[model samples]
Target: MNASLLLLIVALLSGLAFWAGRSRSLVVAGVGGVRTLNSLPFYYGSLTAFWCALPSLVVIFLWSIFDGVFIEKLVHPLIAPAVLEAAHGNMDLVMNQVRNLAASHVSAASVDPSVVAAAERLNSLENINRWAQAGVALSFAVIGAIWIWLRINPQLKARAKVEDIFRWLLFSCALLAILTTIGILLSVLFESLRFFQRVPVTEFLFGLEWSPQTAIRADQQGSSGSFGAVPLFAGTLLIAGIALLVAVPTGLMVAIYLTEYASPRMRSLIKPVLEVLAGIPTVVYGFFAALTVAPLIRDLGLSLGLDQWLAISSESALAAGLVMGVMIIPFVSSLSDDVINAVPQSLRDGALGLGSTHSEVVKLVVIPAALPGIVGSILLAAARAIGETMIVVMAAGLAANLTANPFDSVTTVTVQIVTLLVGDQEFESAKTLAAFALGLVLFMVTLGLNYFALYIVRKYREQYE
Candidate 1:
């Protein structure tokens, strides 16, 4: 059976088990009634459904994980040793060919006779494994349901057992999330370490040039590419600074207007419309930046004769930063709105009672009280702007120039990372591995921002409480 169909069947079985357990509990209650039971009928039903699903899901999960390795072992003997020798003893290549042949991705006539034979064997074994897995899972589900149904009684601690099971499941999910983050960090760290082995850490960090192009052949031009990242860092900061300039004051003003001045009806109408900006895809924003904003800026610059004093590129950081600011406006506004609203009404009233104007009350009482959260939101938005890729790619030209001029074309760390990892790349090469090094640095920067935000939030929260 296919996975989807098997999952549906298990769900139906669990539903049936729930019904059976509830009916059985009612029968057991008898003349004494449900009051005599240790737990409610719902708990019994839940316990039954939990047992019926958990074991079956575990079996499916484990089987899906190891079945490929098991099938590979079974198929290994079927491939001729001569074929392995011919492939320079590269097991992965042979396996790839085998998988392609088995999946009919490659024509059988194009494959060797021995590989063709192994493909057929692999196909057969996979079919058998799927059926076996389905059968075993169903058996476990049925057995678990039956065992729990038989043990159902007035004195059974069904609620406690179900709660304990759920507590552990929640803990497992939290642990899994933590482990996944650790796995990402470790993977990036290891790959970056390999990159640092080829290129010096000091050069990567401090060198002004940002070229990462290495020649594939020794005779090719640019054989020893520069890995200096300073230009990229400068470009990233310049663009991000421009974006913050556009976003911060505008978003905060909007939040204040909505929170302190607008009527309930106006707030209701404007808040949703403002938040819709957040839902628009970044690529759509990118298209707008490239085609509309960039040209408009270029034309305006030409008309105003600013080109005499400064250069205006068709694709400049200004266009990208402006559009990115618009994109993240809702992020800042929404969070600031929430924080501003969280300020104590009593505090505002106290300020007003002291003969302060509405604006004064807002500025002195509300904003100060919510300063920590507002700062946190701005930092979060800054992180969002820094890590943005699609908008930067389309609007900002991919030239890592270290300049503060927003009218000049520039690129960011994310843009460079995407450029470096665009196609089939050899992992052993410094050119490809540079993407991971950029990622590690980006990760650390964002991590620090988030940690600092949390620290500010805790410190301010204690004072307020």
Candidate 2:
């Protein structure tokens, strides 16, 4: 049986076991009195389901892992020598042809009788394997159910055993996440080292020009792509700085107003409306930036009669930054609002009791008390702004201009990373490896921001508490 079918059968059996176990527990309790039972009826049901499924599931899992290899081994020797010679003695190639023929997905233009015979043998073996696995899995399930039913007495510690299994399952999930993160870092690190070998680490880090067009042919000029990443870094910071300039004050003020000054009805109505901005996709924000905000900014800049020097492109950093700032406002506002509200009422009362006004209570007591969380919220929004690609792509043109002017077009690291790895390209080339190097730098920047936010929070948290 296929995995899905097997799982469905096991699930149905487990469900049946649950009901049976619960009913059995009730019957036993009626005879011996409920006080004699060690655990509840629900615990008995859960434990029965666990017993019915766990061992069988493990066996099925192990069988599935080895089934492919076992089937290949069984079919390998059965293949005619002519078919093996046709595959140039390559087991993998022969196996691929065999599998394709078995699945009736042959890609070759010509057919061979030897391959056809081997495919028939392979199909027969697979059918037998499936039946064997199904039989063994069902037998394990039935045996486990019978064993657990016989053991389901008043003295059974069903709840504790079930809880122990759950505890291990949760730990395994956490371990999987940690392992995945480590794998990503190692992959990026190794690829980045390869990139650094081709292009000097100093040049990648500090060089100002940002062209990464490596030619495939040796005869092509500029094939040795300059991997200067300073422009990307500068563009990222410039746009992010502008976004923070707009977002932090506005979002913090919105949070302060909603939490401190606004009436309950106004807070209820306004907060949700503000947070709706977060649910809107970044692409929609990009459209709004490109069609509305960018054009408006350009016209405004031109209308000021300072056209001699004041130039604002339609896809300028200012447009992307402003829209991105608006997009990230919900992040800062939502987090800061929660943090501000978490400040104790006692602190506010104490501040006011010292002849301080309501404004003084908010500014001195509430804000300072919640400063760490507010900083954390701002940093989180800054990170969001840094990582945003669609907005920068649509609003800020992908020109890696290393300039400080917000009115100029610029690109970001994420935009270039997408550009580098979008199509089929040779992975060994410096052009492709450059993406990993960019990713590593981006990861480090984000990690540093998180660490800095933690340090600030820890340093100031106790002082206010």
Q: Cα lDDT for residue 285, model 1? A: 98
Mark the regions of model 2 whose C-alpha exceeds 4 Å error after superposition. Answer: 28-30, 59-140, 217-222, 305-307, 463-465
Clashing pairs in 1: none
lDDT of each: 0.92, 0.89
Best model number under lDDT: 1
What residue runs in model 1 are displaced by over 4 Å at the alpha carbon?
Answer: 217-222, 462-465
For candidate 2, give the lDDT: 0.89
List, residue by residue over 1-465, the lDDT tens digit for candidate 2: 777898899999999999988877887887666677889988888888888898889889899899999888887777788777877888898889889989989743466776777788888988889888888998898888888888888888888988998998899889989999999999999999999988999999999998888787678675567778999999999999999999999999999999999999999999999999999999999999999999998888888864677556778999999999999999999999999999988888888889999989888788888989898899989889999999999999999998887888999999999999977667788889999999999999999999998998888773644
The alpha-carbon lDDT assigned to residue 272 of candidate 2 equals: 97
**lDDT digits (tens) for residues 1-465 of candidate 1:** 899999999999999999988888888988999998999999999899989999999999999999999899988888888889989998888989999998999999987898999999998999999999999999999999999999999999899999999999999999999999999999999999999999999999998998888877668676578999998898898888888998999999999999999999999999999999999999999999999999999999999999998989999999999999998898899999999999888888888999999999988788889888798789988999999999888998999888887888999999999999986556678999999999998999889888988887777652454
TM-score per candidate: 0.96, 0.87
